[model samples]
Target: MHIEQLKQKIVAALEDLKAQDLTILDVKAATSVTDYMIIASGTSSRQVMALARNVQSTAKELDVELLGMEGLDAGEWVLVDLGDILVHLMQPQIRELYDLEKLWGEFANPINHQA
Candidate 1:
């Protein structure tokens, strides 16, 4: 699928599970690994894991290549690698602590999805 369509699918998956504070960061200039980084907060570890699973399922349905996944065991945070896109699912505290937006602020074109 096209990157933008894949992005929209990922966003929809997260939204379906009520992911909070969804933010899409354009990190093409900031990183060589991926073009976009999608960050979202889940109410708890369980929710975080669920969000990750939903993303995975959606990607699979779209036949998008899955590069890798991390932090699923801990469930404090989970990262889904989709070649050109990275999805970060975390608890609110973890999200706050990491502060990815600020870290990538220089090159990031942040798009906030409010719902």
Candidate 2:
């Protein structure tokens, strides 16, 4: 799928699970790994895991290659690699510590998700 389409699918998946403070950073210039970085918060470990799984399943349905996934076992944070789009699912505290939005916030293109 195209990057934009993949982003939309991922965003939809996150929204479906009520991900909080969802943000999409345009990191094409900042990194060679991916074009966009999607960051979101889950209320708890189970929610975090569920959110990650949802995105993975969505990607599979769309035939989007999932390069890698991490933090599922810990559930404090989960990263989904969707070739051109990278997703980060985390709890409030873990999100605060990493502060990915702030780190790459300036580069982010606005997303329509509620914060």
Candidate 3:
């Protein structure tokens, strides 16, 4: 499957798992680091790790080659990079500190969810 389709599948799965405050930013015009940025939160460190793990597993099942990650060791924040699509699974406190959603105002929408 195309990377964009794979990335969207991952996002939908995350939302199914209630990844809080999920935000999808179209960064194509903003930066070269990636085309899309997916920022999501978990209620706790453990849940954050679980959410990251789920993303990893889903990628594996879909046969998408995903970039390996770090921060799962700390369980505070985890990043799953699928090339053009980057996913951040973070704890509430960590997310608050980062404030990623606010950083990308252009991709704003009425998602109305907080994992």
- Give the winner by lDDT: 1
- lDDT of candidate model 2 versus the reference: 0.89
Residue 19 lDDT, candidate 1, scale 0-100? 95
Model 1 C-alpha lDDT per residue in residues 43-63, reported as the tens digit of each score? 999999999999999999999
| Model 3 spans > 4 angstroms off | 106-115
Residue 86 error for model 3, in Å? 0.5
* Sort order, TM-score high to low: 1, 2, 3
Q: What is the C-alpha lDDT of each candidate?
A: 0.93, 0.89, 0.80
Candidate 1's TM-score:
0.96
Q: In candidate 2, residue 102 scores what lDDT?
A: 80
- What tens digits encode model 3's per-residue C-alpha lDDT throughout 18-73? 78878777777777887777888899888888888889888889887787677998
Candidate 1: C-alpha lDDT = 0.93
TM-score of each: 0.96, 0.92, 0.84
> Which numbered prediction scores highest in TM-score against the true structure?
1
